[model samples]
Every structure is written in structure tokens, then in C-alpha cells.
Target: ARPRVGYFYTGKTGSQLLTEKIKKLQVYQYQSMPVVVDESVSVYDAICTMFLEDVGTLFVVDKNSSLVGVLSRKDLLRASLGNSNLEAIPVNIIMTRMPNITFCHKDDLIIDVAEKIIEKQIDAVPVVKHTEHGYEVIGRLTKTNMTKVLVDIAKDEII
Candidate 1:
């Protein structure tokens, strides 16, 4: 006797349909631990943190551990290209400040975060939540996260 398959798909092209299905998934389903660095940390230290964490972006936090800014690989590259002192320059000086930083929440739709990343041309988005003090960084959504989802879907193992 043949084994029963848990999922099946016809020869129909359903890109839009699949996208709609993916959009229904929450960010927490695939979010990674955010790579956080203090805003006062040197740009050089931030680079080291990124390398150690194996992430392309870093979330800048303030003394209260609230989300303050965002720093990307491009940001570091730009700073390094200039004649400024990397060791003395703080990440906050070059980071994209809050209110301008694009982010999502744990309960947010993953597809929406993906769209924001694409639309904003950013490598990742800090998953945040509003606290009594301010927004706190909870997790992170990156292109890799979406790619993993796509790969799983291709293998017919989407969650």
C-alpha cells in the first residue's frame, strides 16, 4: 500500500495565493534574537558585534534598554569609508534614529514585515513593543527569515 501524503498541490500556479497564505503567519513564528548594541558603543565595536552575532544589522538601544536606532552593514561601510575615527565614533552618530527606523511587532504579520523591509530597502526590522517608558526591542525579522519560509514551502513543509 502507498503511504498517505499530508499535503498535496495541483499544477496550478498560485504565487498570489501562496503569498496570501504566508501573510497570515505571525512574526514570532520565525523571528530571531535581535543583535542589540548600546547607542554609545563605538562603530568599531558595533562591527565586531555584528560579526560575532553573524547578523547584517544591529539594533541600537539606549540606557533604558529601549529601541533608539538601527545600524546596518551599509552604515558601517559608509562610516569606515570616511576619515573619521571608527573607535571613537558612536553608533548613534550614524544610525537611523527612531521614528524613522522601520520595525514590526511580535504579533505583526511576517509578510507585512517582509514588505516593509523591501519597501524601505533595509536588511532587517527590529521587532518592538511599546512599554511605559518606550519601545523595547524584542526580536528581529530579516530577509533570511523569509527565505527560510519560502524554502520550507517549496519543500511542502510550511508551518
Candidate 2:
């Protein structure tokens, strides 16, 4: 659960083991790292369906790659209606600010992560960690996948 701990996603573990493995089926697994918008991207792009394919939240990182904020769909709509040049307005103006964004490390267990997401009422959690240069995103966990994990666990308990 702590930051910087390394882990494999369930089947990705490629070994006969359960401990220390985070389930891939229990979290978001994208074909590639989705194109992330920094603090300066256009709102037009924000509304683009292409940008939303695998992203549940628009992560706003600073120039240094540290997560600075997040922009949810509602936030984007509110800004779009208020600004004529939605495409040109800086994202920093509308993004959910720091100190409120909750992130998880990739190594965290799925059950522990599930509780955090449910308690926080977050649809998605950003997976992040520190580097010599700065913190960077590595993955994402979504409510959809968490639901699957919950079902699987329930089935196991019954049987």
C-alpha cells in the first residue's frame, strides 16, 4: 500500500502465487498510457471523446510531472459553458486542486484499494510513485474493475 513498492497484476504475475499480486481484472488496464493533459490543454480537447476512451478522470500534471490536479466531466462542462474560448482556457483554472486528489501506488492490494475508493466515493484512482526527477503516473484503478473484484471475493466466500 505504501508508495514505491513494486507488484504484478494477477495473471501478469506469471507465477503460481497470490501474495504480493494486485489483480489486473480488479483494476484498469489500458492498451497504452492514455494521452494526459497537463495544466495547459484546451477544453475542446478535454471534451473530445477520443481523450475519454480509457480515462475516467483527466489528470492534470504540472510541468514537472507531479500530479497537480484532476478534471472530471462535470468540471469540464461547467467550464465549457462559462468560457467562449473553452479550447484556449488554461486547465489550471478549472481542475480540482491539489491536497484533495487521492492517488494509490501500483503495489497496493485490491481489497485495501477498494475500501479507499468506496469510502472516498471516487470513481477512479490514479496510480503514482516518486522518481529521481519527480512523481509520475503509472496506472489507474476504476470502479468498474473494483466491482468485479468484489463479486469474485463474494463468490469465493460462499463456496
Candidate 3:
């Protein structure tokens, strides 16, 4: 069967609104709890907790609950390599700066967002949205989820 035609909804529908296209687009989306940590927390505890789990990337939020920065395995490694007493150091010092961060809107088209990820050569895109308050991260757009969605699409195309 060919990939079902993608369509938009009306003022609002029920479950019918959830089409095959939407599911495919969201197949790789992870929007539950962000891997966030306090800026004041020791990198040692953060690293210990993060490593024990099997997540690919970890999002670092500050005391204000704003996106202070992002920390990757490579960043932690580099920090450890540079410091013999890395335990005392905070993740913020070694994390990628917010300006260098790439953000994705939850409402943005997934296809468009995925293209951005490819164009930027970034491993992940932080899903953020601004309310009257400030930027709140709702999810993480990661390469792993993208790959999974693409694979499912391919399977559908084959069948």
C-alpha cells in the first residue's frame, strides 16, 4: 500500500484527526520528562545518574528552570579529560552554551524540523515553546527517534 495521503484537520476533530501521516511524523518524538538537572548540582551526581540510564542526550536546565545548556556524552568526557577533580565542577561550565543550542518548536512540522536537524548536523533538537513566562522545553527531537520513524515509513512503503 502506498503511503496514505497526508491531510489537515478541521476546526477540531476526535481520534479521526490522528492520521497515518501524523503518527509517522510523531513516531520518533519523545515528549515526556526532559533529562534536566539543576545548575548547582555537582556534575558527578548528574553524570552518575545520566550514565546509569540508556538515554542518548541530556538536557540541562538551570535553577530558574530555563534552558541553561545541553550536555552530551562527549561534553562530559571532555570535561573529565580536562579536570582531575571534575566531580566538584558544575555541568554548566562544560556544557554547550545556550546560544549554540538548536531549538525546535513542538508545533512545527516534523518533516521541516528533521530537515533542520540534518542541515545543522546536530544530533538532537530541543523542543521548546514560549509562553507568557519563558521558554519551556516540552520534548527532545533526537536522531534515534528520527531513525525509528524513517524505518517505519520504509516498512510501510515496502508493504
Model 3 bad stretches (over 4 Å) = 1-33, 157-159
In candidate 1, which residue ranges exceed 4 Å CA deviation?
1-20
TM-score of each: 0.86, 0.67, 0.74
Question: Which structure among the candidates has the greatest TM-score?
Answer: 1
lDDT of 3 by residue, 55-129 (tens): 656777765577868877777777778788867898878888678888877666677777888997777777876
Number of the top lDDT candidate: 1
Relative to the true structure, how large is the alpha-carbon lDDT of every model?
0.88, 0.66, 0.69
- Runs of candidate 2 with Cα error greater than 4 angstroms are 1-35, 49-54, 154-159
Order the candidate numbers by lDDT, best to worst. 1, 3, 2
Which scores higher on lDDT, 2 or 3? 3
Tens digit per residue, CA lDDT, model 1, 27-63:
9989999989999999999999999989999999999
Q: Show the colliding residue pairs in model 3.
A: none
